[model samples]
Target: TLSEIATMAGVTPSTVSRALNPAASHLLSKKTSERILALCDHVGYRPSLLARGTATGFTYKVAMILHDMEKDLNAHDWNRITCATSAFLQESGYSLVLLRTSEKGTSMDMQVSHFLMSGIADAYITSPSMLKNNTLEMLNSLKSPLFVICEHGVPFPVSDGVLRSDADAFKQVWSRIPKEMHGKICFLSTINDNTQRLLTNIKRAAWDLGIDANNAISTLSLARTSKVPAMEYAEAYHQTKKMIKSFNQFDFVWCISDFFALGVKDALTECGRCPGKDVFILGYGDLETFPGVSEKPVLSTISANTHEIARNMCSVIMKKLDGEHTDIVTVKSSFISRSTF
Candidate 1:
């Protein structure tokens, strides 16, 4: 096949081989390499994995480890990240293998250990949740590169990963709030590490802006006991309705997510309060649609730019695969202002 491609490109077989090899391709002239590559493409001549392995000693496979795969699969941010990462890895001539920590009766530790021993992938990209206690230390012991995608404020010791910038997003939102609503803003968030970080950022920003942080920021944490598929919306609705019944001092409410914001709007309507008129509502994550909210007000929220995060993540992994060190990367979020604020 090499000989055939070389003859068609008017180059020797050895020259074609060198041009096609990833490591040695740089040694050949640009014109010759491009000609050989074009010829190979025209012929649909994908090199055999066995041959490539013999030459490079790499599996060319990257594994993405996800926790709570079923729930995350439907999540907009996770879906976008997975799709973008897969596309980028494919473009870089690598295949992606997805491993769910919750699969089978196997624990996260067992799954990771098995994969490490089996050599199923050359490198790994995982969520911060998967790297807890001994798991992170175990991964660090391996020769293979490991990358983590961490929540906005969760501290990750490793230097090769991406951290979402929820703090920046919160600051942007706080800075843009009307002066009239400065001391009358309420925050509704789920009791999670990421949301806690966001709330902390909001409080810090308020303090920095000379606003009374304690009086300006009122927070309600929705419990995670509910198992409903739409638990976020349901919890927000119930909690907000309760809050409205007892306390109605706040003029603006910021939710941790758009889905929760929609529920907050519904609760406000039930309490005889108009969403945009009586109280402006804000949320994070620019979801496309919210169910049961027909006349949806344009929501003021933060867009995480999952695509950019995925691209950066893939770039870091690629650098690691090439035996290069990568610094920790943080992807900043942008605020989208609309009628809700």
Candidate 2:
């Protein structure tokens, strides 16, 4: 099969081998490696990782520990990160193995221990939440090359990390609103430690911007019992309707996520309130516009730069695997102003 691939690529079998090898791939010309990789992909030829590991003592597999794989797989940021990480890893002749630590009855310690002992993967990439548990301890004790993606909060000192400026991004979004609307702002977010921190930061920003932080800013936290993504939309819609009934003074709604903002917009329209004109709404996570959904209101939100995050995350992991020290990387967020807010 290697010979066949080499023949197709007009290279020798040894050259094909080098192109497919993560460590040795750097020896080959970029053009040659890309051509050989294209042929391999076109032919659907996957090198046996087990065999290669046995021969070279490297699995060429990278384990990705997700917070909650099922729920996060549907979420916009997680989906984009997964795609970008997979693409970058593939280019480096590595494959990704996903593991969920939040699943019921799933022991993260045992899973990580098994991988370490069995040589299932050479390096690991995980969410910051894993640092709160014994997962980080186990990985550190084993001296594994670990890279963390700081999506929620500050991560434990691992090898390196990719951090997001969530609070700063929120402040940026808040600052863009008209000063008059700042006094009538309502924030909708999930009840979590990280969100509580974000809420505090938002309040601080409000005070700094001369908005009445105590009386003007209002907040509602949704219970985190459901993993169903659509439940977020439903809960947001229901709460917006209830907020309208109880306090119809607020003129702006800032949701923690774009999905929730969509629900808030729907509720406003149903209640005979114009989203942009009567009550502007803002959301985080600049999710892609859905296909065949042109009539949906355009949401002004912060783009977390999921693609760049994933790229840098993988880059840091690769550097660690190559015995290079890397520092924590912070990716800035940008505001995407749309029709809604």
Candidate 3:
């Protein structure tokens, strides 16, 4: 069918092939590409992915391995990141294959290995949480393109992935808070590796600014408290309400997420405290709202900048496919000032 289309367009089969692939379509003149595409539309010819893969040795699909979709499917940050990644890949003539490493009916390693051996994807985008001890070894042995989305302390080669520089982000955001409000800082956190690392960085940033962590810094881990449950927003709301009296001790409240920040703001408002005037509030992942129809987010936060991450991921992946050398990319987060601050 492609050969017939090429014949009608007065071009070679190879030219037709390049024109059909959006990523490589620029190789042809606009006039030539338009003619080929119009001819295909006239004939109602749709290219088969299997046929194209067999011929080009590329499946034009990227496997995105995720962990525990059952719970994380509700996360606003991950949803944004995944949607952005898919949109970027789609523009580059690639499809995304979502694979869960947990809550599936098979072992995570086995499922990943099967896909790798089957040539089901041209490349893979994965994070550290999706990998295990054995899975990392298998993934590293892959000759095809593999891009990792991780923070610090991953075992992969530096050139193969991107890192989120949250520590640097903390430093940037900390300096922007009102100097007077820096006297009593309280970190509202959850028990996780990322939260631990972030708290360490936050404390270091304060210390660098001539604020003593021992005297000014205090932490309340939501995960360790009995009042906290599965839901992040609800846990934050109830916990802040239960400890509303204690909140008077803090001059600044740094929340782990926008949801928590909003919850804390609401609780403070209900308890007759001015959030911005009394206690400056800051949150992470500058999300405007929840995943579905929900309360609008108005808290000042450090934006994870999913759009930039997606652009960088797609760029590096394309470069790798074109046999170009790529090094570790560090994406920086920025602060978003809002009424809460």
Candidate with maximal lDDT: 1
> CA lDDT of 5 in candidate 1?
87
Model 3 earns a TM-score of 0.87
The per-candidate count of clashes, in order, stands at 0, 0, 0
| RMSD each, Å | 4.1, 4.0, 3.1
User: Per-prediction TM-score, please?
Assistant: 0.82, 0.80, 0.87
Best model number under TM-score: 3
1-341 per-residue lDDT for model 3 (tens digits): 87888788888988998888899899989998888888888888868987878877888888877665644444666677778888999989998898666543458757767777787687888754455323455565455778887665445543566777676677776777666655578899766525776777778876777767656668876654432223667878888898877787787889987778877888888888888787788988876644553465568888878778878888888888888889878887887787788
**What does candidate 2's lDDT look like per residue over 247-271, in tens digits?**
3677888888887888888988999
**Which lDDT tens digits does candidate 1 get at residues 165-207?**
7666777777877777866787877665346667777788777
Query: Residue 160 in model 3: shift from native, Å?
Result: 1.3
True-structure lDDT of candidate 3: 0.74
Model 2: clashing residue pairs?
none
Model 2 regions more than 4 Å off = 1-16, 21-48, 100-111, 128-135, 152-155, 190-194, 204-216, 222-225, 288-297
Instruction: Kindly report which residue stretches of model 3 are placed more than 4 angstroms away from their true locations once superposed.
Output: 29-31, 102-108, 131-135, 138-141, 153-158, 191-194, 208-211, 223-230, 289-297
lDDT of each: 0.75, 0.75, 0.74
Which pairs clash inside model 1? none
